[model samples]
Target: MEQKVFIKYFSGTMSRGTRGIVFLLAIALLAICAQNTQARVTLENGVKSKVYLSPKIALHQGSVANKYYYDMEFPKGHIAIKSFNAEVVDEEGNPVSLKETYLHHWVAARYYQRKGIKEPKHYGNLGFQQSDHIPAGNAGVCNSASGLSQFFGLGSETRKTSTHVPDPYGIEVGNPLEIPSGYEEKWLLNVHAIDTRGVVDAMGCTECRCSLYNVTVDEYGQPFKPNYAGGLYCCYDETQCKVKNGLESVKRNVYMKYTVTWVDWSESIIPVKIYIFDVTDSWQYTGIHDCLIEFDVEQSTTNECMDTRRSKSSFPIAGDVVYGVAHLHSGGIGSALYGEDGRVICSSRAIYGEGNEAGDESGYIVGMTTCYPKPGSIKIANGEVLTLESNYSSQKSHIGVMGLFYILVAESSTTLGSPVQIHQESKVPIFFWGVAAFGLAIFAAIVVAYRRRRQNGDGYHSIAT
Candidate 1:
């Protein structure tokens, strides 16, 4: 409980507006720490995972792991946070082990800081900070198991074994998953819960279960056509411009699933939370017939994007359809074309094949969600939302990137119908239509009066002559 409070409070200060998902992360970390210090969580698999002290702080779980799952850009060839489990499981369900001594360590995969059109063409490096063994075994694997142990940096034996990985768990796609400043896509997230590394390594129930969440960003960094007039779009090349350009930060949910389990513990449980965000205008097209003109949202509603990088949605539109692309971190895998009523019509997953690794595509936006329009309804009515979900998180998925997108669900009212052209001529307002109608009527009456007067005058002139 105290840990949760600490994170929430700290997050309030550290996070900038709701924009700081780091606040949520801080909350999660606090919960994690609390679970380690003062609580017990029991699971269905008979493995009881918990924090060991006062007031039992944190959600119960033999399931649900959110903090573990991450959705970030993964550089090509990098081995990242696949999965991690922390729990103590003897043959019997026991939250507390009378004779087990524990040691914990924190491990992370670090990437090289380099700039490129997409994610780097290579994987980065990883290292584990170690810890000294626990001096006392009086309490449950609460604070000690989850927090103290890891912060000290204990190393693992499984991490050393590269030759014999019995089960391959992770979305292993080729190339790198990219997410620059403006890249945007619907995002999903998850976290893994690990309590006892020893038992997880021993039991071989290595596949971990996790929690999920969601997030929505304003836009993908793929710049729109340069506005030579304002010089705002030119910042893509300058790199030094101070103008803010990362899309609107909008996190809405978080999801959970499983990753890796080289631990030896019995089946365990975990509790986690999730967060997700959306980029409201993500559905627009960028480059096809022309770059400036956006393909109608109506087309996007019906035809899902095929071949995200090399392909597009040809909605049988009037003009040639153009293309616009976006990206998100790893946790954004399950993104798809959902209807206004929340019915998913087409999806990026189906086009790319469900659960395809984000790192597989060479040209697709990095960390991008692979979604498409559903078959039945491609067009969206007002008040509809696209839920991008999937891919549990890990340390590897945390590098900041872009997020969820929208395709002009509705534009600003003041700037509404003003465009290059309209459905027929111009989008004159309702009042404009009324005024034009009145003017036409007055002009017609004047013309009628002139014709009658002229006819009378002609008759009189003829009689006088």
Candidate 2:
């Protein structure tokens, strides 16, 4: 009997030990899983896409066109835009008029600097230097990302009905317009609006250069300030500038949708910087169109439209230029880019809508064509000035308008990393592991409690006998 009892006891002890071993193994696995979950995130290779839009702005009487900037927010890391699209719509998702109504232009860009530095310097007002005056209330945001000047002419110069880009991204597949670290985590979006109502030649007056006004009287003849600083009108006569008080009221909203496709880089890569130079930088706005120089087609007179080179400014750029393009409006003949010593670099010509088409309306001047240079073909050295010779027709009277906007794209030469990339990479791993460790500890505690209960049950059974 004792031998049988001894055997039974031995078997029970072995079974308990085995059960303990199995439980311990499970706990260890749970611990590892918990640790891994806490340590790193499981990632999948794919593209990330999102949509953003500007605030809906109302267009009222005497409003011709308006311009404003929107700062786009994005995650940190190397951000490359694979696809981009912009359009105007009503509340019902229907398209607005392409002839009279337009999203004149929308520019997408980040900040750029030539000299390498540990931290980015506050870019003074976008369109001004340190000595320039900033509107009293506007001084706080003058030259920073929130300031309008840095991205002044960085986007489309003329009106765009719409833009849709398909896969195999330009620059490189999976590669996008990178927003470098240390720079603002925002993309500047410039928006323009136009409305041509109550004008006699809203459609067919071949010669019309609209005059934009600020703080104009509304259709009710009451003075009102628009959402933006100015508005566009097909003003042939100075008398048309006055608000027609009894005219039928018209209201429209400027709506925009921007789609950005990007790749979440496994590791951060060098970013691409965008540089913009507007010919207006050299010319001042006098509010009179005819007084400025012109390229006369009728009298066969042309003006040598020369301005100080952009390189003459403190704007610094290093490294090879990957892509370059120009923005021109109606009456623009073409633009010539020049390096130091008057050597012509490249010329981007304008293509007008000859016959009456949808975008190429009969009377109105339509869009300007853009150009792209071969990768690495154009290189601007530090302190080098680039002169933009812009050509516009003297045959038609055009508003004191823009000439060529030379946009150059290059790799970041600055040392500061994108804050987005640093934040994303540093925190994710720590968070994952921390959570996993907590889970493993909880699981271990449960196992220990169960074992204690089993031992108590055995003792209770022995006493009950």
lDDT of each: 0.25, 0.44
Which residue ranges in model 1 land beyond 4 Å of their true spot?
1-326, 330-332, 350-376, 385-392, 395-397, 406-465
Q: What tens digits encode model 2's per-residue C-alpha lDDT throughout 1-465?
A: 997985455345444655476457657756776665543333323555555556675665434434444234433455444445555566665555545453445555443322233332332114323222121111111133323233323222243422222222222222234323333333445555545555444322122232333225543355533332222333211223234457887777766656555555433433444454455442223321121111212322446532222312223655445444466545566676677767655666655554544445543345444444554565667656667667766554444345534443454363323332322333344445655665564455556545656887777432355
Clashes of each: 125, 19
Name the TM-score of candidate 1. Answer: 0.18
The stretch of ten residues in a row with the least summed lDDT in candidate 2 is 133-142
TM-score of each: 0.18, 0.51
lDDT of 1 at 175: 16
RMSD to the native, candidate 1? 33.2
Model 1, poorest ten-residue lDDT window?
266-275
Per-residue accuracy of model 1 over 398-455 as CA lDDT, tens digit each: 2122222212111111121221111132333334444455455434444544555577
- lDDT accuracy of residue 149 in candidate 1: 17
